[model samples]
Structure formats: structure tokens, C-alpha cells
Target chain A: MDDRRVAVVVEDDEDIRELMVALLGQSGFEVHAAANGTDGVDAVKENDPVLVTVDLGLPDIDGYEVTRRVRRFTDAYVVMLTARNEEIDTLMGLDAGADDYLTKPFRPRELRARVEAMLRRPRVAQAPVGTQAPIPTSVPAVPEHGQGDTAGQAAGPTSAAAGSAAAAPSGPAGRTDGSSADARLVLNGLVLYPHVHHVEAEGRDVTLTPTEFVLLETLLRSGRVVRSKAELTRILRGDEPDAGTFVSESDERTVEVHVGNMRRKLGDDPRRPRWIETVRGIGYRAAGAAETSG
Target chain B: MTTAPVIDTDALGRLGEQLGDPEVLCGFIRRYEKMLGQRVERLHHALNTQDHDDWMDAVLSLKTSSAMAGAAALSQLAAELQDYLAKRPPDPVRWPVTDCLESVMAKLRHLARETARQLRLFLNRLSASPQLA
Candidate 1:
């Protein structure tokens, strides 16, 4: 079985497309290239790539439409590459289901950093056979304490559980069977399985992009503690929360958009959010049980 | 008057490093040259026919492809043409003077040629470098 990663480049411009193919190929991905949206989507379907870089402008269909189409079937990471650097374009691209966005003339180092940061997040698990996984309603065994390294390193379930166990005393709640219950966080009918990278709202599966999944998991684990947009941006970038990394306004806006999209996907209205609440000038937090019970 | 570089060698160098293989980078440069020729032809046809939509497509393509290939001057020229075409009314009667369009096209052609020539030189240097080879 070929375990090498696969990547698809959906760019109309031959130069950019070839550059991406070569770059991804060097990065150990089996690279496939398509020059138009139609062929791009087709290539994605056939290849089942783990990463897809798409250009905003295409001959047959736009990148937005292509992203929406790809989102229907796979959770492959989508990165939008566009010459248009306008804020509206960035917002639209992210809102249309792209996992990340890079403006044209972007430095290769910048692109590599973005790609590396995204790949650090755990990929979503394949859909379970038969019935959907049950949502755990018990208290979460892990609080995801510490604002930095712990959250950054807890990419998979075992690591998160292991970290939590090391930090907190192992009570009777600790399972000997190694069930994912130790890493599950439940609030107001929204359940997040951090170990398995799955979420369920009101007993129905809620599909989130890997970024959205991590954002929701972070908010849920924080309980009612409000996380600032800058902090969230750092978290999304895989930077330590307290690191001196400069979080640009665009990066903060991206966090806001991801949260907005997450709310939409979970069917939680911002005005009366049951899963996530806006903190006005600050950032976002999971809505308290008291607030949602009303 | 100072002139902007026809090619941003640093950008191409970074791309070469990211690609890791000298041969792959040289092949990309060759493909870029071929694609540049096709795009230039398309731009000339668009200008001759005054097809606003075709012009927009061709110029936008050139701008993005040139930027990716590190053709700084050509990409800037394409961007100017994009802005110019965008501001003009679609009606041919309201279009800019023919001579002005001709001058812009001539500049675009010259820049493309220079950018391609510099890329070829860069490729040759890379091919000849003992370490890279």
C-alpha cells in the first residue's frame, strides 16, 4: 500500500501550477496537477489527496465553487492561492470552505510555513461503519490546561490523554480500557471527541474543517473562559499561545471567520449561541450551561 | 530613471530551494517560457480585437503567471494593463487611443522578452553550477 501523502494543485497558470507541483513533490507528496476547476475537482475525486492547493481564478468554474464541491465528499485540506489580496477576497475564500489562504507573489517560505502549520493538526478520522459514534455526556477527563505547549502538542487522542494524566491525578474516572471518553468534551448537546477528531451536535454528526475542529475543541475545553482573537490566531498557527509571534489583523479576522463558520455548522446562532458565545471586545468561549439552559 | 528588475532572482532562488532539485527548477523555467509565449499571443489577439473580456482574462493570467515565475517587471506591467482595462468602458468607441494601446503592448512584449531571457540565463547558471548539478 502506498502510504505517501498525495496533493493536488488546481491552478490555471502553468507557472504557479508547476511550481506548486514541484514544491509538493519535493515535500514527499505524490503531486497531481489540473489547470481548470473542472479538471481540478475531477482530479481531487480520483486522487483523494490529503492536500489541495486551488487558485481563485479558473477557466470553467471558480475556486469557491470547487471548494464547496470538494467539501461535500472529503475533508482534504484546501488552500486558496489568489492574486487578489483584498480582505473581502480572503474572507470569501475562507467562508467558501478553504482551510487556508495565500495571496499571490507569496514567499515560498510563507507558503511552507502555512502548509506545515496546517499539517500539524490531526486529520479527521474516517467515518465509522454502521451507526454514528455515540456522544459522551460525562464530565471531560481532560481540561487541556496550560495556555501553550500542552494544547499545541495534543494533536492526537493518546497524546492529549497522556498529557492530561501526567498533569492531573488519575482518579477513578480514569479508564483502564483506554477509551476515548477521557478526551471527550461535552457541552449543551455538542460533543467533541478530541482523540478521534469528531464532533456531534444534537446527536447528528457535524463536519468541520480540521481548523474548525481544533478551534471548537479549544473553546469547549476552555469551558467558560474567553479566549482572545490573537491567542486563538496563535493557537491556529500552531504557535505557543504566549509566544511573541506577531498575529496580524488578517490572522485575527481569520479566527473570527473560522468561529463564525463553526457556529453556522453547529447550527448555533451567534445571538443565542448554545455552543459558542462572542465576548464583544474580547473573543469567544463556549456558552455556559446556565446561559444555554435558558 | 531607475528601472525595476525584469526578474526577481531572489524569488526564483527561493522557489528553486523549495523545489530542491535543480533539474526540476530548470524544467519549470522552460515550461514558463513556453506558457509565456502562448499568453503573450493571446494578449496580442485580445488587443487587436479589443475583446474586453478576453483582454481581462489574458492580462490576469499573465500577471499571475509572471509573478509566480519571478518576472517582476512583466507582472507589474500586466497589473497596470489589468487596472487600465478594468477602468475602460467595454464599448470599443469609448476605448483608449489605438496608439496608446499599441505602446502598452509594445512595452509588454519587450518586458516579456527580457524576463524570458533572464530566466534562461538563470537556468543556464544553475545547470552549470557544480554544487547544484
Candidate 2:
């Protein structure tokens, strides 16, 4: 089996395309290049790459449409490339499902660093949870109410407490034992299976991008605790929230966009959110079931 | 008049280091050189035809590629042109678009040629130097 990681570069300019291909190739990726958006989409479908870099301006379809199309099939990390350094472009790219964006004339080292950081983050497993091989009975069961400091503390009304019983450790912060892998978190009728990268809301399966899934899972695990934008930014960058990494304004805004997109997909209204709620001037938290039950 | 240094050798060196292969860097330079003419021609045609969309595309393509290949002067020129075109009035009541564009076009052509030449020379130096190769 070919275990080498794959990357697709979707750029219209031949020079930039070749440069990206060479760069990614040097990074140990099996690179596939496309000069237009149509071809780019086709290449992504054919290759199922772990990473994709898209140019916002293409001869045929724009990068946003291509990203949307790609998201339907795969959770590949997309990094949008644009000559314009406008904030609107970045926000649009994220809204369209790109995990990140780099302005043109970007330093090669910066690009490499971004790519490395993204690749370090775990990708959601594609397989459904039920199809996986069964766990042995000898393995200890995950605690119903985790005693760890990072465990979901029961908050809000009775429904929130009930929901916290199934909460698992969020990200690497609270995960002590491997047993948290099998834990299932429930909040306001939304169910998250952390091990399998699956989510269900009111018995209906919810499709979330890898970034969205991580954010949602983190919020669910935090129960009513507010996760600051800077903290979430670090988390998305694949760093421990308190890793003391400098969080830039742009990084926090990127988190805001991702969270907004996730809310839209989850049908959670910001004004009257059922699952994720904005704490205002702080960041975001999962709405308690009772507050949302109205 | 002699133009300011068309290429930023330092940026190119950094790119080479990031790529981790001198050969790939040379290949990219060659590709950039080969595509320079078409990109300039596209820009000229777009301006002549008053196709704003194509003009933006051509300018951005040139700017981004030049920047990546370390053609600093050419990239800067393209960026200026982009800003000028973007801010130009639709009616052209105050400033005559064609008259200004003619001068800008000439500058663009000269810079593009110089960029290509400098890139080729850099490639030759890299090829000859065993230390770099």
C-alpha cells in the first residue's frame, strides 16, 4: 500500500503551480497539480489528498466554489492562496470551507510552517463508529462522570448535568487515559463520538468539517465553560491552549469564522443558539439544554 | 537608464533553502522565465481591450509569480499598476486612462524583460557554482 501523504495544488499560474508542486514534493507529499478550478476539483476527487492549496482566482470556477465542492466528499485541509491580502478574502475562504489562507508573495518558510502545523493536527477517521472492530470487555469502561479537572462539569439546569455525564476530555488538555477515546458526549440532544469523528443531533447525523468537529467536541466537553477566542485559536493551531503561543488577532478572527460556519451548519442560531452560544466579549460556550429548550 | 536590481537574490536563496533542493529552485526559475512573456502579453491585451476582469487576473498573476521568483522590482511594479487600475475612475473624467496606461505598459514591458534576464543569469550562476548546486 502507498502510505505516502498526498497534496494537491490548485493554481492557475504555471509558475506558482510548479513552485507549489516542487515545495510540496520536497515536503514528502505526493503532489498533484491543476491549473484551473475544474481540473482542481477533479484532481482532488481522484487523489483524495490530505492537503490542498487553492488559488482564489482561477480561469473557470473560483476557489470558493471548488472548496465547497471538495468539502462534500472529503475533509482535506485546504489552504487558499490569494494575491490580495484583504480580510474579506480570508473570511470568504474560511466560510467556503478552507482551513487556512496565505496571501501571495508569502514567505516560503511561512508556508512550510503553516503546512506543518496543519498536518500535525489529527484528521477525522472516515469510517463510521459501528463498523469498527469491537473493544475487548477487559478494557476498563470510560467513567460516566469523569473525575479529571478537565472533565465536563455539570452546569446549567438538570438537562445540562445529564449531558455532562457523557462528556469526554476535550482535545489534549484533559485526556489522561486512552479510555476517553471511547467516550460519547451528549449536549442538548447533540451526540459526539470523539473516537470515530461522528456526530448526531436528535438522531440525525451531522456532517462537520474536521475543524468544526474539533471545535464542537471541545465546546461539548467544556460544558458551560467559556472558551476564549485566543484559546480556541491555539487549539485550532494544534497547540495546547495555554502553550504560551502568541495568538494574533487574525488567528482569533479565523476561529470566529470557523465557529460561525459551524453554527450555521449545526442550525444553531447565534441569537438563540441551541448548542453553541457566544458569550460576547469572551468567546463561545455550549448552550445548556434547558436554556435552549424554550 | 540602468534599472534597480530586478531580482532579490536573498529571497531566491531563502526559497531555495525552503525547497531544500537547488535543482527545484532552478526549475522554478526556468518556468518563471518561460511564462513571463505570455503573462505580459496577456496584461497588454487585457489593458488594450479594457477588460477589467482579465486585467486584474493578468496583473495579479504577474505580481504573484514575480514575487515568488524573487523578481522584486517587477512584482512591485505590478502591484502599483494593480492599485492604479483599481482606483481609476470608470468615466476617466479627471485622468486619461489610456495616456497613463501607455506609460505604465512600457514600464511593465521593460521590467518583465529585465526580470527574465536576471533570473536566467541567476540560474547560470547556480548551475556553475558547485557549492550552490
Q: Give the candidate number with the greatest TM-score.
A: 2
Badly placed stretches (over 4 Å) of model 1 are: A1-3, A130-207, A243-246, A265-272, A289-294, B48-54, B87-94, B130-133
Q: What is the TM-score of each candidate against the true structure?
A: 0.78, 0.82
Model 1 CAPRI quality = medium
Tell me the tens digit of each residue's lDDT in model 1 across A65-183: 88877765556678998877668888888877788999877766687788776665434333222213442444222222242111111222322123222322222111222343335
Alpha carbon deviation, residue A188, candidate 1 (Å): 4.2
- Stretches of candidate 2 off by over 4 Å are A128-183, A195-206, A289-294, B1-4, B88-96, B130-133
What is the TM-score of candidate 1? 0.78
Model 2 residue A52 CA deviation (Å) reads 1.4
Candidate 1's residue-wise lDDT over B53-90, tens digit each? Answer: 67877888888777767788888888877877677667
Task: Tell me how candidate 2 scores on lDDT.
Answer: 0.73
> What DockQ values do the models have?
0.54, 0.66
Interface RMSD of each: 2.1, 1.1
